[model samples]
Target chain A: MTFSDIPKFKLKEYSKAPELSSKTIAHKPVIIVGSGPVGLAAALDLAQKGHEVTILTAFDFIALGSKAICFAKQSLDIFDRLGIGERIIEKGVIWNIGKLFWKDQTNPVFQFDMLPVTNQKNPGFVNIQQYYVEDYLVDALEDMDNVDIRWGHSISDIEVRNDGARLDVDTRDGSYQIDADYVLACDGFRSKIRDSMGLDFEGRIFEDNFLIADIKFKGKAAEQRPSERWFWFDPPFCPGGTALLHKQPDDVWRLDFQLGWDIDREAVLKPENVEPYVKGMLGDDIEFEREWYSVYTFQCRRMNRFVHGPVIFVGDSAHLVSPFGARGANGGLSDAENIAWKLDLVMRGIAPRSLIESYNDERIMGADENIRNSSRSTDFMSPKNEQSLAFRNAVLELSNDYSFARPFINSGRLSTPTPYHDSPLSTVDNDEWDGGPKPGFPCVDAPVNDNEDSNWLLEKLGNDFKLLQFGGKAPESDLDVINIPIDSLAAQRYDAHHGATYLIRPDQVVAARWKEAQADDINGAYQRAIGAA
Target chain B: MDKFNDTVNISGHDDIYQMIVDLHADGNEEKSQKINAKLIIAMINQIGSEQIVKEIIEMVRLNEEKYNPRSSTH
Candidate 1:
C-alpha cells in the first residue's frame, strides 16, 4: 500500500471490560502492557504455546508514521516462527548494501554489505513501516484463542509483590484491577510502569535533533532511485549536517536531516521549510509529497536490570538507543523472543523461574553493545567537540586516499544479531574444532537434506531442544535427534567429525557441543541449558 | 621538527579519559601522576613511532601551556 493509502491512527474497537470489585478481580497468567510490536509478538508466542496472555494497552491502534523501517534478518527469523514471516517479507523492501558519503564529496567514502551469505532463508534487512509489522502481528494474535488483547486500557498504577504484580488499569467505562503472575512491560520509552517502580533509565542524550520525513514520489523518477541505504556526513544539498535516505515499499522514501539543537523545532517542521530541504536533495523536477514528519533527539539509555522480581521490562521500556543503527524495534523483537520461551518454560513448570535471569543477562549485554555502537556512530556523525570534529574530518579526508582509513569512517555500524558468547548457559568448549558457530551463538542457517526433502537447517530445528548428530550414529535420548549425512552443509558448517554432536536450545542457540556423542553429555547439557542442573 | 604520521589515531578520547578518571579515583594525586606518566611511556613504546610520540608530546605541551591555570587571565 502507498503511504497515502495507509490509515492514520485508525483505532481498533475495544469492548468495555466489566467493572471490577475487589472480589471480582481477575488473575491472569501473563499481562503484557503496550500493544506495540514487542507486546504483540510476545503475546502471540506465549499464546501459541497454549498459555493465556492478556495484552493491555492505552492505544488501540498501531503506531502512526513509518517510525522504525528496518527489520534485521534475525528478527525476521523470529517473525517467521511467529507465523508472519511470509507476509512481512512480501510487504517489506529488502536491501543489504549501504553507501556512506562525506560532506561535499561527490563519491561515497565507504560501502558495507550486511549479508554475505546468499543461501540464507531471510535477507539481511527489510524496510517496512513499524505500523505494518504491528498490524500483521495483531492480526495473527487475533486468530489465537489463548490471547486477549484489550485496547484503550491505560495502566494507571502498578504494584509488585513477591508472588506477582497488581496493576490498576483504567478503561473507557471504568477502572479495574488485574493480578498477573508475571508482567511484561512492552510500553514505550516514557514508561509509567518503570517510573512507578522507581527504576532509572540511565545514559547520555545527544544534543542533535533529527527531522524525519516520509515522502512519497510517483512515476519513473522515484522507481529509478537505487533501493539502498544512503547516508551523507555533509552534502552540499544539506549543508553543515548529516542526512539519510532509505527506500520503503510502495514508492515511499524515508529521509532524515540532522538539525542542530539550536534550531526552532516548530518553524523547521513547516511544509515550506521542509520543501526546500527535499528540493535541494532531489532537485525541483521530482514531484513528491510529505506523508509524515517528526523531530527526534537521540538518547542511549537503559534500565539497570531488565528483570525486577515478578515484573520484567521488555523492548523500549527497558532500553532506548539512538536510531542510527535501527536497533529500537529490532532489539525489542529480540527481547520478546528471548523472554517468551523462558516465560513459557517457567509457566509450564518445565524450567525453574531462575531461567528468566539469563534473559536479563543476555539482553542487557545486547543493549550495552547496541548503545556502544550507536553512541560511536552518533559521535562520528555529529562530533561533540573540536578534537572529535578534527578526527572525523581527517578520517573523511584520508578515506578518499587510503583503504586502511576507510574503516575509521563510521556512519552507522548497522544492526547485527548480538552473540551470547559469554552466556552462563553455554557450555565451555572442551575439544578443538575448526570453523563453525561456537556455543552460545545463534544457529546459522544452511541447506540440508531431511529425509530426501531439501530444507533449511533452521527450518528443521524449530523452537525446541534438539540434538544434532553429524555423520554419526544417533544416540538414544528423550530429546529429538536429527542425524545428517557426513558431507552435508550442516556438517561442513559445524566442522563436524564423525561423531560430533551439538545440543541446540529452545531459542535455537547452541547450548553445548561435543567432539563425540555421549548420552550422558547430551543429558547434562540439556539439563544445564534448561536451568535444571 | 619531527614529521609524524599526520593522521588521526586516537579515537574514543572520552572513554580513555574516563578510564584515567577511574584509575585516579583513590584520591592519591601523586600516585595518579606516576601512573599517568608510566601509561604514557607504555603507550609510546607500544606505538613504536618516535616521530608520532614526539608530535603527541609537543601537542600536549602546547595545550598545557595555553590552558594552564597560571597562564589563564581569569
Candidate 2:
C-alpha cells in the first residue's frame, strides 16, 4: 500500500490543573514531567500499581516525525505488560532479518537474524513510528481514572525538599505549584528539570551529523521491497558514509544518511540537495514524496547518578545515546519499568527509600552498556583517525571471503535487553545450572496454554513478584505462585528439568532461582530482592 | 605436507581492535608506539612462552621486511 499523505495528529490546547479546596498547592503522589514514551509508560505502570499519577507535558499533541522507528522485542514485551502491545504490533512492520551491504554490492556482505532464541511472542523488532506509540499510550492512560495527563504544562522551577520536591509549573491557563512526592524527569535531551536542578551528564558527543529523509515511494516499487532493515557502508550512492533504510507502517520509509562533520547543515538539508541521494538509492524512475526531513547530531551521555533526592531522572533526562542502536527509546522504557515498580514499593512503605538506590546502580549499569555499544558502533561507522579507518576497512574487506571478520563489521549493534549481571537486587545463584536465564536477567518467554487458550509465560507472569514453580503445587506464601509442568517449552527454556523454581521480580526480571524451593531461602531472597534484607 | 590451524584466537576481536585504535585517537605516534611496546611486553608475559614469542617476533620481522624492505629492522 502506498501512502503519499503524511499522518496528521490533532494538537490539544492546555488545561489547568484542578483547583483544590483545602490546599492552595496541589499535592500529587507522582508528577511525571514529559509526555514521551518513557513518561507515559512510567505513568501507566505506576497508575496500574494503584498510585495517583499526573503526567505533565510541554507539547499538547502527539509528536510529529517518525522518530525512534525501531522498537526492540524487549520494548514490545514491556508494551504488552502495559496493555498496548497488540495495537503496536498490529500497526508496526515486524522485521527480524537485517541485511548489511558493503559498497555497491547487490548481495549483502553479512546478514543477521535479530532473534537467535525463538518461540517468543514478539518478533526481534517492530518498525513503528514513535508518535503512534505515544498516541496509543496516551489513549490507554486516558482510560485509567488515576492517570491525569496535563497538556502544555512545563516546569519553570523546582525546589528539592527532604520529603519530596515542589515544582513551579507554567501552563497555558496560568502558573501553579505542585507538591509531588516524586518527580520523574522524562523530559528529552534538553531536560528542563535536569537543567533547573543544576545537574549535567558525563558522556561523549560524537562528531558526525545524520540527515533523516522519511519518504514514501509511488507505484509498486514501495510494496515490492521487503520490510527488512537495509544498511549500506560506503555505498556508491553515498560514498565514504553510511546509509540505513527502514520501513514503517503506511508505506512510510526512513532513510538515514551519515554526513561527515565538515558539511554545511543548511545546504545539506535542502530538498534539492537531498533529492539526488534519494534518487541514487531508489532509482530515478521511482517516484517518491518527502514526508519529513531532519538533520540531527547525537551524543552518548548520562547523568552521574539518575537519582537526586526525591527527583529521579528517566529516559533522555537520565541518559542519551547515539541513535544507531535504537537504545535511546528502548533504554528509556527499561528505565521507566525499573523505577515504576521500585517507586511503587517505596511509596507503599513496603520497602525503604534506599531501595531506589538500586534503581540508580542498575540503570547506570544499563546506561553504561548502551553507551559502550553505541560508542563502539559510532567509532566503527565514523572512524576517529586513519588507524581506526584502516581497521574498519580491513574488517569490511576481509568479510567478503572470511566469515570470522564479518562479526567485526558492525553497521550498528541492534538493541537487546541488558542483563544486570552484577545488580545488587539479584540474589546470586546457589545451585549450578546448565542453560537458563540466570539471576539479574530478563525472563525468556515461551508459548504456553492456560486452560485451552494459548498465552505467553511472560503474560502469565504479569508485573508482579511471583514464584514460578515447575512440576510442583502452589507453595504457601504471600507471593503469587505460577505452577507449570516440567514437560513444557517454558520449562525447557528455563531449564526446569529437576523442578527448578524462579523468583521473578515485578519487572519480570529473575531475582533468584533455586534447584528446590526452601522456605527460609525464599524468604531471604525475597527480602533481598525488595531491598528489605 | 604441513597442516595449519587457521582459527581465530581473539575473543571479542572487534573490541580489542577498538581499544587499540582508541589508544591512538590523540594521533600521538610516539606515545602510541611506547604504549604499544608496553602492551606487547605485558601480552608476552601473559603468553608466557619464550619460543612462541621468538617465533612471533621472527614472523613479524619477516612480514615487515617483505612489505617495506627499506624500513626493515634487521
Candidate 3:
C-alpha cells in the first residue's frame, strides 16, 4: 500500500494540559522532546526500567514519511530490548546482501554480505518505514502508566539550571512550564534546544543533492525482484550520477538518484522529472506508483558536546551524518540505549551522577566514527575537484576488470555498530583473551540451550549487569549469573577456552572479562562500570 | 644485501613495473604527473595499511633527500 492509503495515528489529547494544571510548574524526572523513533525509544527504555518519563512533541499524529527505512542489526537488538523487535522483524523486509554496479554494466562489480558473522539473534538489517518503528515505540510507551506523552506540546524555551532543566512548553491552546531533572533532545537536525543553548554543530557539508523517490511496484514484479540493496555508479539511466535502490515492506522500493549540484530542486521533484529516472532504472514496461519524493543535501555536522548541564542531546540533535550509510536512525537508537541505562541508574541512585559523563564520551566516539565513514563515502561519490574525479573514475574503471581495484570502489559503507573500546567506563584487560568482545565492545549473541530449550544469549542477559561465566560457578554476588557449558556455541563465540568470566554492563557492553573471576576483582569492575570507581 | 632482502611484497613484479613504465611512455610531464598521482592513490588504497604506507612515504622522502638534493632558485 502507498503512503496515502495508511491512516495517520492521531494521539489522544492531554486530559489536563500542564499549563492548565493547578501547580505553577509540573516536575518530572525525565522529559524527552520529539516523538520520533529515537525519542520514543529513549522514553520506552526509561519507562521500562521503572523511571517516570514525560514526552513532549509538537505533532499530534504520526508523521507520514518513509524516512530511515534501513534498521541495522544492532538497532534491531536494541528494539528487541525495548519490547518491539519481534513485531518490527515480522513486518519489515530483511536484507543482508548489497550489490554495487559500475557504469552500464548490468552485472555487479562486487557483492557483500552485511553479516559476516553468522547465527545471530537478529538479521543484518531490516527495512521498515520509520513510522512503524515510532508507532511501535509509542505503543509500548502508552502501555506503561509511568510515561506521559504530551502531544501538541512543543518546547519554546529551556533553562539549564544548576538543579535541573525548566522547559517552557507551548501547546495549541496555551503554554506550560515543566521542571525536569533531565531533558533529552531527540528532536531532529534543527534542534530547538541546541539553538536556544547557543551550541555549535560544526562539520563538513557535502555538495551534491539526492532526489529520493520511494515507489511501490505493482503486481508480481515486486516479489520477483531480489530483496537486496543495489547501488549503481554512472549507469545508463543516470550518467555521471549515483543511484541506490532498497526494498522496503509492502513492495515499496526506495530509489535515490544523485542530482548534480546545480539543479532546480522543485523541477526535479516534479513527477515528470522523477518518472523519467524511475523508468530509466525500472524500464518502460514496468507498472509502478510513486509514494513519496524528496530532495535533500546531507551534512556531517554534530555538537562538540552532547551533554550540557541538565539537558542532553540524543539522535540527530547530537550529530548528523550523510544518508549514504543509513547511520542516522541506527546511530540515534544506540544513543538512546546508551543514555537510557545511565539515566536509569542515576535516577535510582544506584550509580553516581558522573556516570552520565561517559554517555558524552562514548556517543561522541560513535558519532565521529559515523561521520568519518559517511564523509569518506560522500567524497568518493561526489569528488570535489577534477583530480579527485579522475581518481574516482580511475578506481571505478579499474574495478570493473581488476579484483584488487574493487576495494577502492566506494559506493557507500553500510552502517554497523561502532564499538566503544576507548570508553572510560570500561576496565582495561589484564587477562589474555585471544577472541571475544573486548572491554566496551557490544556483546556478541549466540545460541545456547536453556534447560534443554533453545535460547539466545543476548535475550537472556536482559537490561542489567550480568556475569556470563563459562564452565565454572561464579562467586556469590548480587549480580545475575549465567553459566554456560564449555562446548556450547556461546562459549566458542566468546572464545571461553578455560573457564572465562565476563562482566557485562546494563547496555550489554562488555565492561571487563577475566580468565578467572575473583570476588574483589568482580566487585571492582562492577564499580567501575557504574562509575563508582 | 640487506637492501635486496626484499621483505615487501611486489607480486607480479615485472608486469606491474612495466605498466608503470608504460604510463610515462610518450606522455608530457604534466600528464605523467597526473598519472603518477592517481597511481599513488590507487596503490595506497591497494596497500590498505596506514603503517606500511607511512613507512613507504618516509622511505621515498629519505631517498629524495639523499639522491636529489634541493637546488636554490639559481
Candidate 4:
C-alpha cells in the first residue's frame, strides 16, 4: 500500500487484524502479491503452467532501480529456462572481465574473467540494470495469456483459509476481492502481505548507509574496456572510499557512493560535488555528467518464516542482503527460480501442497548463506567499529604488495554462495573425494556430443530438479530420463557420485548422489519430493 | 504470529542434507554435521575470505580447533 497505509502494522485488537479475519480468503487459484522480481517470476511461472495468475504492486515498473546490475550465471540459466534468456542476453552487458584500480600508481588488477568456462551455459553474471530485467519480465508476463500485472495496485488485506487465500487489493482503479488456491508474497522488505499474515522477518540491520549514484561516464576509458567492472579502493578524489564502477551502457557507469555518516546526500549527488570524485578517480579527461542518483541503507535481515497459511514470501519479501556479495537481486531471482517450479507442479497436481514446503526450506538456506557472505564483505568494506576499520585498512594497505598481499586480496573479501549441508531434500555426505559432482555441485564443465550445442546440459536442466543419470540402461520406463550425457562432462562429473546416476534439483543442489541407479530407490526419491507413491 | 522472521527471509532451504545422509548412514547428525561443516569450510577455506570465515564462525559457534580460513589457502 501507500506509506500512509500504516506506519508498521500495529493493531491493539487481535480480531481487528485483517490477516486474522475470515474476510481474507482467496477465490482464485493463485494470487501473487507485489510485482518485483520474485512476484513477476511467480506470476510468469504459474501462468506458464496453465494457472491463472495476478500480480499486485504499489509502484509501476519505471521507478524500479532500472540500473541494478550483476546477474549470476545461475540466474542466467534460470532466465534462459524462462525462454527470456535470449532477450536478456541480447539486452544486458556481459561483465566477464573486471579490473580493480587500487590507485593510479598501482597497475589495474583483474579478479574474475567475466565468462569463465563453467559447466553452466552462460559465462558469469550479466551486468544488466535491474530495471531492464524487470521490463523484460513485465513484457514476458504481459504476453502470457494467463498472467496479469496490476500496477499501482496495493494489497489491503490478507486472510488465509483452509483451501486457499483471499486478498482485498486496492489498486489506483478500485479494490476487488480475489480468491486463490495459494498466495505468493514477493512484496519486498517492509512487506505488507507478510505483516498482515503475521510472519517473522528477522535479522541484523547495519547502521552505515550507502549512496548510489548512476551517472554517464563522460571521461575516456583507460586500457581496460567497459566489459569489466572496476572498483577503486583509494584515489585522490575519494580516499578510503570504495567505489564500484560498473558499465551500464556505452560509456555510462553506474557509480555506488559509499557515503559516510555526515555526508549530505544532496551535496554529494550534485553534478558539481560528483565531478570532483569522478575527476580524482578517472582523471580530468572530459565533461562531467550524471544520469541518476539515490541513497539507501544496507541491512542483512531475513524472514523467520517464509510461509504462513497459503501466503509465501519470495525475493526481497523473504530476505534483504547487503549488496556486497551481489546477492541482493541475484538471490531474489533465485528465490523466484526455486518457488516457481514447485508452485507450478502443485498447481498442475503433479505434487502435493506439502511439497511446497521445500520452497521455504531450501530458499531460506540460500538466503542465510547470502546474508552471511554479504555481511562479511560489508563489514570489511565499510566497518562501523573503529578497530574493525583499522583492521580493514591494514588488509587494504597490505594488498599493495603483489606477493603476500595478493592472496588475501584474491580471496574476495566478500561474496560467496553458502553450502547447504543438512536439508531434508539433500543427499550429500560431507565426505572426502569420491568424485563426480558432489552434494554442493560446484560449476564444472559438462560435455555435449557432436553438433549438439556446447550448452546442451545446462540448457536442458537449468532450473528443474535434474536427474543426471549416467545410468547405462533405464531401470524402468517411468523415470524421467532427462538426457544424461555419455562420455560427456556431465556424465564424468557424476561418475563418482553415482556411477550410473545422480539427482540434481532446480536450485542445483544434489537431491541424491548415488553410485548406481536402483529402480525402486530412484522412483522413491522422486516420490518423496513430489509426495507421490 | 510473532513476526516469526520479518524484515528477513526465513524461507529458502528444505533439504534434509542431514536426513538423507543420516538415513544413508543410520541417523547420526553429529558425525554428519561435523564432516559437512568441515567439507564446506575446506572448500570455502580454499576459496578464501577472511570476512566469510569470521562471520561463519560467529554464526555457528563450533568449539572445534581453530582453522584460520586464510591459513588453509596459504
Candidate 5:
C-alpha cells in the first residue's frame, strides 16, 4: 500500500505495575520481550494452550515500513494455526513465478515457479507489508484472555537466574521489576536482552549496502507491469550494481538497488539522487511518487545457543540473515512455532526440560541452511573477487544458450521449510516406503472426507499428538487416531499399503512412521518424541 | 612459430589480471604464490588438455631463461 494509505497503529501506555513494591516483585508465568510477529505468534500459541503469557514491548506501534513483504507457504500454514492465515492471504499479493535477468538482456535468463499446484490452501509466496502482519497478530492476541500485552514497557536490564529471570523494566509512569518463570527474547536483531546477558552472534557481515525504496505508481503503465518477482544482475537502469522489483498491494512497488561498498550514504539516499535511478528503470513516461526509502547492510549471524537456563531467544534475537531469500521473517515465525509447543509441553510437565533443547538444535540447523543459501546468493549478486565474478558472468552468458547452465544461475534461493531429518526427536525409519513425508519432515496436506464433510488432512490432525492409521482399522490407543481408507489421497501420500501409521507432533511434523502399528512401538516413539526416554 | 602451441581459448584477460591483483591485495607474498600455484593446477584440471598444459610449462620455462640476468642470452 501507499505510505499515506498504510494504517497507523496507535501506541498505548501501560499502567504502572501493581505488584511492584520494594519487598514484592510482580511474578508472571511467561514474559515475551517483543510484540512483533514472532513474539505475538508465540504468545497466541502458548495462550491458546491455556498458559498465561505476558508480552513486553518497548513501543506500542508496529514497524513503519513494508519491511518483509514475501511470506512463504510454510509460514502461512503456521499463521493458519494462529488464526490469521486467511486474512493475510486475502490482503496479500500472491505470486509463484520469479524472473531473473542479466545486464541489459531483453529476455530473462531463467524463470522459476515456486509452486505449480493450485489445489493447495496457500500459494508459494505472498507479498504483504510487515506492519499489516503485526497489526493482524495484535488483533488476534487481544482476543485471548490469557495474554497480557504491555506497551511502552522497555527492559533496561535482565538477570537470568537458574530458576527464572528477573527483568528491570522502564515505563512512563515508573520503573518496576517483574519476575517470570521463563523469559523469551523476541526483541529482534539488536536484542537488548541478549546484549544484557552478554550473548553474541558469531557470523559474517557483508560489506555491500542496498537501498530499498517503496514507491507508488498508479495508472495504465503500472497496470501493464506483471505481478512477479523480477531480479536483474547489473541492470542498465542501475549500472554497475544489481536491481530487484516486486509488486506489492495498493499500487505500491518495492525496488532494491545495490550500491557498492564505497559510496556517500547520505548523498545516495536523497530524493534527487534516487529519482534518476527510478526514472531510468521506469523510463521518462511513467510517473511515480516515493513512499519510503532506507539503506541497509545485511549480516548472516546467529547466537551459539537459543536457550540459556530460564531465558531463551527466538526470532531475530536468536538469528539474523540477509533478506534476499525472504528467510528473515519466515525463519523467525518458524522459530516461534517450534518453541511455543515445546515450551508449552515443558511448562505443563508433559515433557522433560530437555525437549526444549531440540528447539535450539533444530532451529539452529534451519538458521544455518538459511545463512548458507542467502550468503551464496549475496556472493553471486555481489561477487567479492574477480574469479567469482568471472564464474557468475560465465553462468549468466551460458544461460542464454544452454539449458544446463540455467541451474547454475544464482538468484536468491527462496525460503523453504527446513526438514529436521537428523533431529533426535524423530524415530528412525525401519521399513521401506515410497514418496511421502519421512520422519522429522512436515506433514503434507491432502483433501479428505471426514465426518461427511470435505476437509484437509492437516486440519483433522489438530494441535496435539495423533496417529494416522491408513488402509486398516485404527488400533485402540489413548492418543487420537484417524483411519483413512486404502484408496484415499491420504493413504497414497503416506505410502500406505495396508497398515501404515504415522505419529505427528503438535507442530504438524512427522515424528515417526511405520508399516504396522503396535502399542509398545507407538508408546516408545511418542516417549522419544517428547524426550522422556 | 606458435608462441605456446596452445589450443585452449582464453577470454577476459583484463578481468583475469584484475583478479590476480585482487588476490594479492593482502600483500602476503608466500600465500599469494601458493594461491597462484593452486589456481594454475585448477585451471589445468578444468582445461583437461595435457598437451596445452605442457606447452604452457615450456613457454614459462623459456620466458624465465630469457629474463634470467645470469644466462648467456642475457
Candidate 6:
C-alpha cells in the first residue's frame, strides 16, 4: 500500500513517562523487552508481585498503534487485580454475538452464545481495541513505584549466560547497557530478543495479506446487530470475501478485509479506490469516515521454545497468529498473566525457577491451539485453493439445514484457546468423583450461578492459579489455590460431560484434571507443575 | 458454541473469519502527523491483501438487504 493518500483520522495517543527516578540498576531482577501486550502484562504482573521490574520499549508507549482489541475473560480478570479492567470495560464494547452474511442471506450462524457461558458471568469474550487495553495497562503501571518504563529504547544486543542476562539497549538519543537477573521477551513476532538468542520460529507463513480499516458510521448501519462481530460469505458486496465489522467502545467500527495477495498496492490504496472498498463491504447505501487503514501479512509462526535461559518470551514474541481468532493479543496477554504469577512465586522464593517451565508448557499449548483455530479460520476466509472453497461451500450449503453441522459452515474459522491433554508438568489424577468444569478451562455459566453475585467469581478466579472442585472436602494441600466449591446438583448436570476437579494455571489451561480428590492431591498437582511435590 | 470438549467450543467456520485488530495511541504529547500516516498505512499493510474484492461485491449483491450496510462506507 502506498504511504501517501492516508486519510486524516482520530488517533488515540498514549503519553510516555518522561523519566524514571534513578535507582540502583544492578539490583533489578526482571527486565522486559518490548512494551507490547506481552511485555506490559508481564511487567504489570511482575511489578505487582513486589519484584524490581523494568521495561524497555522501542517507541513511546502511546505512539504505537498496538494492533489488538478486547481481552478474553482470562485477560480481563488479570486487569482486575491491576485495577485497569474497569476503565477498559468502560471504554470498550461488550459483544457476545457475531453475525455472518452469505449469498442474499443474512445469518447469525455462529454465535459464541452457544459456547457455554463463562462461569455464569462473562460469556466467551469481550471486545475492546488493543490500544485501549495497552493504554490502561501502561497507565496503571506508570503509577506503580516498583515498575520502571524506558520508552524509545530497544534491545540492541542480548547476552545470556550463567549470570542472568546482559542487554545492550539503544535509544534514539543514545545507548546504554542494562543487566537483569531475568529477562521476559515480550517483544513481537520480529522479536530481537528471540533472534539474538538464536531460536527458531517454526510455522507456515500464510501467503495472504490482510487489511484492517477503522471507520465511523455516516448513517444507520444496514446490518446493525448487537453481536459485535460480523462476517460475509456470499455474493453482492463481498462474496467469499472476508471482512470483519466490529464495534469499538467509542462508537467507531473496525472493518478488516483481506485484499488478496495480488492486488496492486498503490492503486488499491488511492483515495478514490479506498472508498469503494468501504462502500462495497458496508453496502452502496452506507457511508463511513475512514479512521485508519493498514495492511499486514498472515503469518502463523511461533518460536520453537518460548523460554530461553533467564530470558523468556511472551505475547507475539512467543507466537504470531493471523488475527482470525482474535487470538494474537488476547493469547499474548494470557501469557503475561500466566508467567507473571509463576515468576512472582519463583522470584520471591516461594516457588522454584522450574515454575517458569509451566509458562512454556501452557502457552505453547495455547499457541498451538490459537494457531490451529486461527489458521483454520484464516484458511476458511482465504481458502487456499478451489478444493477448500468447494468444501467450505458445501458446509455452508448444509449449514442452515443441518443444525448439527451448521458450525462448520457458519464459523468462519475462529481460533479459541486449546487445552493440554498431556502435560509433563501437569498431572492427570484419576479419582472417581462426579465431573464438573475441568481445570485448564472454558468457564461455563451453570444454572446455579445465575442470580447470585457471580461476577466476582468470574472476574478473579482464572486470573491466578484457580483450583476448582465439586462437593466433598476441598483438596487440602500447599498449592496456591482458590477453592470453587460446587454443589452436587449443578455438578451432575454439568458433570455428565465434566470430569473431576481441575487445577488451572494462571493462563487458564488445565494443569491437571482429576476425577476425585485423593489425599495430598492438591500438593501433588502443585508439585508436578512447579517441582514442589 | 461448537463443542470441541466439555467447555471451550469455538463456533462458526464455513463463513469468512473476521478478526478485529485494534490500533491505539497510548498518551502522546506531540502531534506526530507522520506517525498517524505511517501507522494508518502500516496497519492496513500489516494485514493487507486477502484478495476479497470479488467476494466483497458478491456479499453486497447477495446480502444487500440482510446486511445493515454503514452509510459512510458506501
lDDT measured at residue A104 in model 6 versus the true structure, 0 to 100: 64
**Candidate 2 per-residue C-alpha lDDT over A227-302 given as tens digits, one digit per residue, 9 for 90 to 100:** 8999999988899999999999888889999988888999998999999889888777888889889899989999
The worst-scoring run of ten residues by lDDT in candidate 6 chain A lies at A1-10
CAPRI quality of model 4: incorrect
lDDT of 4 by residue, A22-120 (tens): 455435677788766667766776676678887767664434342347787767776777778888888777766666666555466436565545555
Interface RMSD for model 6 amounts to 19.5
DockQ winner: 3
Evaluate model 4: give its lDDT. 0.64
Minimum summed lDDT over a 10-residue window in model 1 chain A is located at A1-10
On a 0 to 1 DockQ scale, where is model 5?
A: 0.04
Off by over 4 Å in 6: A1-27, A64-66, A107-115, A222-227, A400-405, A410-415, A439-455, A459-519, B1-74
Give the Å error, residue A174, model 1.
0.4
Q: Each model's TM-score, in the order given?
A: 0.87, 0.87, 0.92, 0.78, 0.86, 0.77
Q: Which stretches of candidate 5 lie over 4 Å from their true place?
A: A1-9, A20-23, A116-118, A449-454, B1-74
lDDT tens digits, residues A34-121, model 5?
A: 9778898888889888999999988756657658899998888888887898899999999899999888887898999988645566
True contacts kept of each: 0.00, 0.00, 0.13, 0.00, 0.00, 0.00
lDDT by residue for model 6 (A427-532), tens: 7556553544454554443444434554344454554566666545456665454444454344554462343456766555566666666657766776676656
Clashing residue pairs, candidate 3? none
What DockQ does each prediction reach against the true complex?
A: 0.04, 0.05, 0.25, 0.02, 0.04, 0.01
* Candidate 2 ranges beyond 4 A from true positions: A1-8, A19-23, A449-452, B1-74
Residue lDDT tens for model 2, B1-74:
22222367659888989999998899886566555644664566556666777777888888998987884465
What is model 3's interface RMSD?
A: 3.0
Model 3 misplaced regions, further than 4 Å: A1-16, A452-454, B1-21, B26-50, B58-74
Q: For model 1, state the Cα shift of residue B32 in Å.
A: 30
All models: lDDT? 0.84, 0.87, 0.87, 0.64, 0.84, 0.65
Residue pairs that clash (backbone atoms under 3 angstroms), model 5: none
Among all windows of 10 consecutive residues in model 1 chain B, the one with the lowest summed lDDT is B33-42
What digit string (tens of lDDT, one per residue) describes model 1 on residues A91-201?
999999999887666678888888987777888999998888989999998898888888888999999977799999987677888899999999889898998898888
